[model samples]
Target: MNTAPPHQQAALLRRYQHRIHRVPRNLVVQPTGFCNLDCTYCYLPDRDDKTPMPTAVAEAVARSASELVGGHHRKPLGLIWHAGEPLALGRRRFTELLQPFEELRRKGLLEHAVQTNATLIDDEWCDLLTEYGFRVGVSIDGPKDLTLRRTDRRGRPAFDRIMRGVERLQHRGVPFSLIAVVSRENITHPDRLLDFLAALRPVSIGLNIEESEGVNTERHPPTREQAIEFWLKVLAWSRRQPGGTAPVRELERLGRYLRMSRTQRADRAHLSRVDPLPTIARNGDVFLLSPELAGITAPTYNDFRAGNVLEQPISAILREAHRLSYVGEFLTGLEECESTCEFFDYCRGSQAGNRYFEHQTFAVAETDYCRVTEQAPVLALADTVRKERTT
Candidate 1:
């Protein structure tokens, strides 16, 4: 934790408020909307669609990369294959899909990554992923008993297939990060979850608290206090590990924020004119702010599309994104959080998708999602650091 004096830290945080940028940092690409397993809490609306992105669409997106991220002066934009199981497209098609980004990768303007359920990993897939130098993130809830929510379309448990894939990756010497969703059944059992995750020896662990987003409306284990307690337990459990095995993702972010130097904090940016993260659908439509809004549609918000990369360049779409009502409302929400919320510096405005899904509007502040994901973790980590100092 940062040991700077209290007054100095407060002064630095106030200055950090102005460090906002409009540059696109992450481009989430959906190779296909097909997923092998029907996870119960999944927010995706088009997970059944097997239509892969046309090669032309990929070329178009690649062509606009330099302009979208402000050219080579800025760091490489993170090109993440997500929104569905990217690996489900199979090795041959996935390889062909990657061809368009080769020049961008060579130019150091793009970094490739994939987030998958890991139920289809094989030696061929591993070879392709390793050849392309793609960072992998596997989605697994926990042990077999806890992962009852992750099942196939026919209601068969997917734990065995998922582990088979994970073991194959381990055998291939491929490093991966684990992403788990903590639903009502597993939120109260952090110890078991952490222990199981640590045994996998992943590079890191990310936990997404079960949310009432998209079509999944049945909220479970709903309580602010329970969520906070769960996070505090997670922080305590992570600290007890030797060398912090598979460090909890939320706490790691908090630690980074707390330990950043004055200069580093000042260099960080948010509350920008445009959403820094953009998700490109299989057909080339672009959705700003939230990847969860890719397949979702609402008549009031022009279906939540900024523009289609197939019709215009990504730079043009982003340049005029503010004109979109939802985008403008999201910006307003950011301003409200910046002026009102103490945790604004941490989560920026908590996620625009959550605001819309929970309240049907993007111009709102203080949703249950932010309280659990942003506020609780910060409070838990701060309390831990304070206790350590006194000891």
Candidate 2:
């Protein structure tokens, strides 16, 4: 490594900062810290705390949302309510939690969504959901057996109840998506997984593999070949079920790759779905990057609370993030990925939280998470294309 002057190094970093700019419009809120179920591989450290979000934090989020809508490079501002279990707050509390975003949503300036375990959604919840027209994402690990880790507090099976909640939503004509955690058991069983999810008719299917984060110490990472095969199987199944199942996220990413390749736009080559999302804890703390980082900690960054919007302006927090050494290193790592990684155009550089949590440093190029998430899916799609050409 060249030992350069501090100012010269700073200038060098700035020259490549464009590859890592972040102005996240989506705000993920942990409305409450109470859940009826206790998943075995949960990453949240305070899943049992019953305290709800202070009114001040909600107000700050609203202010932040208002500020974000006018940003130069900002995407549409979205308020995503997620936590120990957002549904456990009940309809009334949940509605109260959404008060800050309702006005923005009505103004057609904000998008509001929630992620729930789907065990507590009754007819009342469905009615409220329909009334507000809020987007919901249901958390289920595909089939019943695949959900062994996602049981109720008593260690009893919660899949049936979760399915019931899903049925309630379906009967009421409420739109929702499915978010399945890819465990060791489910990662190898893509056919059964796709069949189960396809039967649900959700708006979309999202996969979140179990990995090391927060309190979770181990991750059952898939082999690169296993990941490629599973994703290819999902893509193949998606093509056959045009009208039956929702669009899978992995397939959607592949779709993006196809279009990007066709256009061959170099400027947009290194873009992810969005930049690092800004997450707010129930009390008022604010953290940027991956939503998982909101609950987890890092040695260099501590709790990773860049700044609290309650104390300072949201813009100020973002500006002050310039000082975080890890943030700088994360940016440098992104520049490295952009210059070196073949999939940089599609995935940007994977998520900061994943790299930091797994490799314990944000300065690294890539981690095991990127191997399956960013590389495998695209490679699978490319493999299909090669096979088609040969045939």
Candidate 3:
């Protein structure tokens, strides 16, 4: 559909000569998958283990992270506390797990963040979050009725509990953000969702389009037209708001495509490639790229693991990631994508999960996500931009 003339495509390609920025160091540590709520669309359901990473293992992982960043000129590596519910580790143990990273931060080795469901946040948790400079991103679907589907394993509604925790954070003046997953049931009600988020007044809101992953395989993604309608309404609502905290709308492919077209680079607002962003699992196995890779363990082979942090140094993991044929091939695919496609300057290529789902290999390009997010939107944006320029 992106049938830009050859001359226009060449001009666009020439405008984007700079290389994509590569993240030097970062780690997502899954302290535990012990979440209190069982949202219907959770991608981490396979990680239902309640086993917490031992203090020693946490320390080892932190040390490895520090070393990796240090080797890369001490770039600010983000240490994301990811999990079923990282807060489920309880206050004391969570603090213990973070102490090593805190020490690393003090030494200017890395930054820290936490992604939680916010059901357990209290004054004490908020205090810790503020004290440690942890950027909190809470998971909550729009209003109470919509969020009721977020229940415990035993099917108990968790909206009130999560809101109570969110209130604690707000009352304590702890800096936090929100992550909402949009589903078919909620796609047509962007105003209602935006109203609810505006009331929360979070620092920013990230809206994720529902995808078929983990236990969420049964969930239905909105049609492309539905997605476009939802995002356009959200954008219009955001522009109309007077003093309300504007939502970021993370998965709005149109905005990303427009930004990419104008600037000749992919918007880095969403998650980056999984290779440099490691996910340290419960058993100390370090999975390069994404936590999704951890759920892909086969009985006969163990290819996802870069190495065990407890047994190997962080440098080894980085080196191993660089050595992965998939990593090299994936990067090449991105380069090829950039060179060949008229929309190349605007896309970061396909996500690993999408690639795996569509092609069964990480190195292959995912045409589905590309068409829906990059190609179609790029054509639409170019038309708008060209018209504006003409006028």
Strongest candidate by TM-score: 2
Tell me the tens digit of each residue's lDDT in model 1 across 1-391: 1235678555433432233235677889998998888988877888899999888888888877766655348778889999778888888788888898898788777889999888999998899888888889999999999999999999899999999999999999999999998877898899999899889989999998888888787756346777888888998887688974777778888877766634465546542333447788999999888888887879888788888888998877765555567765676677788899999877767788999999999888889899888898888777777889999
What is residue 224's positional error in candidate 2, in angstroms?
Answer: 1.8
Residues 334-353, candidate 3: write the lDDT tens digits: 66765676655446565555
Candidate 1, which segments miss by more than 4 Å at Cα? Answer: 1-20, 261-264, 268-275, 385-391
Q: In model 2, which regions exceed 4 Å deviation?
A: 1-17, 20-22, 71-75, 266-274
Candidate 3 pairs with clashing backbones: 274-289, 275-289
Q: Rank the candidates by TM-score, best first.
A: 2, 1, 3
What number of backbone clashes does candidate 1 have, counting pairs of residues 3 or more apart or in separate chains? Answer: 0
> How many steric clashes does model 3 contain?
2
**Each model's lDDT:** 0.81, 0.78, 0.69
